[model samples]
Target: MEPCPECGASMDPRSCDELFHALLALDHSRQAPWGPLHGVSVSCFLLQHPSRLPADDGAMAWALLHTYLEGGLDEVNQLVGQARRDNSHRVKGGPLRVVRDAPLPHRDASRSRFSVTIQDVAVDGTFPSSAFTERVKAWAAATVDAWSCGT
Candidate 1:
């Protein structure tokens, strides 16, 4: 479905969910080993910040459930590292933490902050702090993409 041309707001959750599911299903059909993304759940929210206001900040986020046959946590750790490095160059506040987490992502009551907790589904163990920060970065990017279609 097309987004709102004026404000770019597509306030339909079903449409967004269907689009994401369809994309994942089609992609999985061609790639047999694409198990990193087992399932995903997405929801949208309006971003409101008093200090830094976004131009058109309707945000969409996804809860990605992933599974890896071999070295799952290891791979997530690597991705997290990359995310942290990338985010550092963008934000001036310092750095964000990304790690293997358990609790689902959530927005703070104040609506000023949010977080995504990626639990290590692997049997190995919890991931390191430095590595976890990277995951946060990746998740943020993905969330932004899923929300606005880069508009």
Candidate 2:
């Protein structure tokens, strides 16, 4: 398989999508320790794949990621309900929307240019709730760090 142009992970082998879907699956266990961090995981994934996002959604992803960067989980937790209510479609526990309001043809950025991706973290396999939660935060933090470098 070829490396993903955005995150540099191998494609078709379920690299990024695997991690994202696993995090998305956490909706059934929102009461679990890793539940609340789903937004972070979602934002990180969307931000890494800029081409899939429209211009407006790209801005939303950046703002959402920035919120996690500045306020941590407590702040991100505050935005979760609003994101869900913004659209009828479910994103599991992800931030904002997984399905964009606009098409990707007029996107703001074609490339993500991220320094960090799911590849940068130990996201494979299973983990205890607390450890899984930590990895989500770590992935988000790494995404923010990439933004900080203006990538």
Candidate 3:
């Protein structure tokens, strides 16, 4: 195995493959085949790459970033679901907000904006840093092309 120039560390293909699989598991799916890999995958990767411990600042930093991003995605989904529910509700509580362009007042006030202001609704939950939130939004938008919006 050749040394990774970035950190002067030998790159083990097996460990890299495991890391990739672990990353894939971070994506939310009802059929998440990877199950809970939080410590197991990290430990396995570190076992194969002894010189590259999981807690190494670089690796830990990436893990933190990954968790932050995953958390952000969950929040985005929650917001989207809240908006959907609010639209179906008989009263105000969730993501429903009044819009100036609407002709009807009651139901039109429940429409959600497909803009950054969607994050301003304050649905009661903590979030990652604003920078992480912005990155997650960008990631969602970019990946939308890869997902099917069909019935």
lDDT of 1: 0.32
Q: Please write out the lDDT profile of model 1 over residues 92-146, one tens digit for every residue.
A: 7654433333233233322322223122211122223334334534434434343
Where is model 2 more than 4 Å wrong at Cα? 11-13, 81-115, 120-122, 127-130
What tens digits encode model 3's per-residue C-alpha lDDT throughout 30-98?
A: 233222222322332332233564333223323322332455435434444544566685756654432
Q: What is the TM-score of each predicted model, taking all chains together?
A: 0.26, 0.64, 0.21
Candidate 2 lDDT by residue in tens digits, 1-151? 8788777776554667776666567644776765666566667788777657654656556666667767777666665556557654643553445332322223433344555566554344343454666666667767656555553
For candidate 3, the per-residue lDDT at 31 reads 31
Ranking by lDDT: 2, 1, 3
Runs of candidate 3 with Cα error greater than 4 angstroms are: 1-31, 54-151
| Residue 132 C-alpha lDDT in model 3 | 33
Error of 1 at 125 (Å): 37
**How much is 54 displaced in model 2, in angstroms?**
4.6
Winner by lDDT between candidate 3 and candidate 2: 2
Better structure of 1 and 2 per lDDT? 2
RMSD of each: 15.8, 6.8, 19.0
